[model samples]
Target: MLSFLEGHTSEVCACAWSPAGSILASGSGDSMARIWTIADVMSRSSLQNEHSSVVVLKHVKGKTNEKNKDVTTLDWNKFCSAPPASYPSGMGCASCGHVKFKAGSARHGVFRVEGRLLATGSYDGQARIWSTNGKLKSILNKHKGPIFSLKWSKKGDYILTGSVYKTAIVWDVKAEEWKQQFEFHSGPILDVDWRNNVSFATSSSDNMIYVCKFGESHPIKTFSGHQKVVLLFLFSFSSGKKGDMWVSAKHYFVWAKLTVSNGTPTGSLLASCSDDITAKIWSMKQDKYVHDLREHAKEIYTIRWSPTGPGTNNPNKQLLLASASFDTTVKLWDVDQGRLICSLNGHRGPVYSVAFGPNGEYLVSGSLDKSMHIWSLKECKIVKTYPGSGGIFEVCWNKEGNKIAASFADNTVCVLDFRM
Candidate 1:
């Protein structure tokens, strides 16, 4: 919907929703990555608001009413390189203004924990880091093929990059080099997830998932049961809930991202979407489905568990699940009972992404319909609509739920400043 934010020259490839505060990152084939934030950069509503995030970085140390600062510094070239000479003096960060970097065809982009930094992978067989002000910080040019996926370590100390070369790399963000390199997949690596600050898992087109760690040359564990490429895998952690962490891998079953309850002491509750047009809640310990939610008529694409939980953020509240599907619908489920508490339908095409606000009071969805919807979960109604220039590939709420970011098929990313 936000057209004023335009810089890419080709179709956007991937987008990352900041687990931190109000920040967003998008990668495009135009060989560029863009970072976005709201105009009120100093707003700290995200603190103590994103469930129980342990990696959130502190705000910039300066104190002179940083609110109303432009989301990003001006005069930084679209290439994320040094500003051109024709620009007026003092147009950009004096120090980073002279840094040299040329953004390649971006394949993926993600923001680090505090929203102060970003990492983007490109078709140029490289990855680049940028500061929150959109200044280029570092460039990693090591992979052999276009990097397709990336995952930052929980503490923001490491970054894992997956590529089409049947290989993956773990880069030390501070040391600025490959901490370790891994190669075991028979085909291209499609997805990756960090299970802890030091270990992670990778799903490959070869139909396998590998558990690897830093400084290790071989996989510590491997899973091989999928009949087709394992296209999706997600790692989730909740410090407020027994300090538990888990990873889910999606296979030919038409995988869906799974979310764990924030802080349930008994056991972790996971919700998964499937191509069978159903949402199921499973017990991590029992390894069995506990409840089944059937309402959608088409394959479900995404699912997210509310950050609030039974014993944590909102002890008195029910744990909720949000599921989006190809049927152009988003459904909210009551986890304990597996009941379809509410069905939200407003998109004209397949719903590709759905996310719960940090407060668990709102939900946002994006779709091939070229629009984004912000729904009030408590009201079961679409409260707001944002127009778009192309079909949306993804939509996500920042940690505080104060900003929503959507990636477009038209090679652009739009960040909406949400007020509710």
Candidate 2:
């Protein structure tokens, strides 16, 4: 731990790591959010505390606030992943300007992947964009209620936002206008995720999941088969499956379950988890279980593959799979070997999210026990931990793997500087 960040006069509500790991932005009950820089944290000379041996990470950026409303949540623009220009490939919004806008209450914030624009949603019933340096960009005023979720396209050309108004909107960034809006949800939309640049999936309080595409007035596919939110869906005959939670005759559809996902665009391979107490990777070639990832003694609830997989981001990338189980362990697997590489243990409760850093050098997991662990794949050990906080709802790494963000029950967000 660098010195404990102490500026949030209240429970921190939400935090997000920038697209690059240089900055960590956290929101709190104080109606404030602060951005901290990793370079500033690392460059400081070490000094011993008068009271204890633990090193404290100091906050370089002061508390950032708007309107004295509890900051709710935020996200990083994950779209600008173009390797590198003249500078480094992954430094995020910290390099932009610094300006804050007063709003009703911030519900979420996201940076453009190119690290040029930032968007924030507030209870004021608006979504806004700004320059990376915090200069005001534009205000997207359409949703009549608070915006809860936002996702930028991989191409960085479009933005998606879901709101409490039972609607989701897609905005065209280049034109500075909203191109399409979805209002079919019977209740407030709870979450929105992009399947690709052109298609997305939305889950609503109406107990439905809809697959929508750009410019479509109606959903291309609607899923009403689950009693609860389905985090991910997988299809494959190449890997393995055991539980009867779901079954499909051909391809394109399968049983959906809790956390764990990452799919190729062509649907050549699929990975998913279920109540069957197993982690299975199914493929198109065999249409059955190819490798049964087993080790956790309890139900495996979450799984995630390295974003830079064999066919996607990295051409020569090593295929890796990670799974979090009720057994209080996070296991890393060598997909090619069909073997469990190692298991990480430290959390005292069910793990909620398991994410692989974009570079595939580290893996992070958050749990109900209010702890976040960063494990080094090279060392196969728990490297650092941001101990003790409200139960974490989710954890994610920026594209460069330099920083991380976690959402908590305390209504706070914590961003930690990571070195892997």
Q: lDDT per residue, candidate 2, 137-169, as tens digits?
A: 666778887676676666566778888789999
Position 22, candidate 2: lDDT: 57
Candidate 1 global lDDT: 0.59
Off by over 4 Å in 1: 1-3, 15-23, 40-113, 215-229, 238-296, 310-316, 333-342
Q: Candidate 2: where is the Cα deviation over 4 Å?
A: 1-3, 40-70, 78-113, 174-176, 231-303, 313-344, 376-386, 402-420
User: Per-candidate TM vs. native?
Assistant: 0.67, 0.63
Model 2 per-residue lDDT at 382: 82
Note the Cα lDDT for every prediction shown.
0.59, 0.57
**lDDT score for residue 16 of model 1:** 62
Clashing pairs in 1: 1-387, 31-104, 31-105
Question: How far off is residue 302 in model 1, in Å?
Answer: 3.1
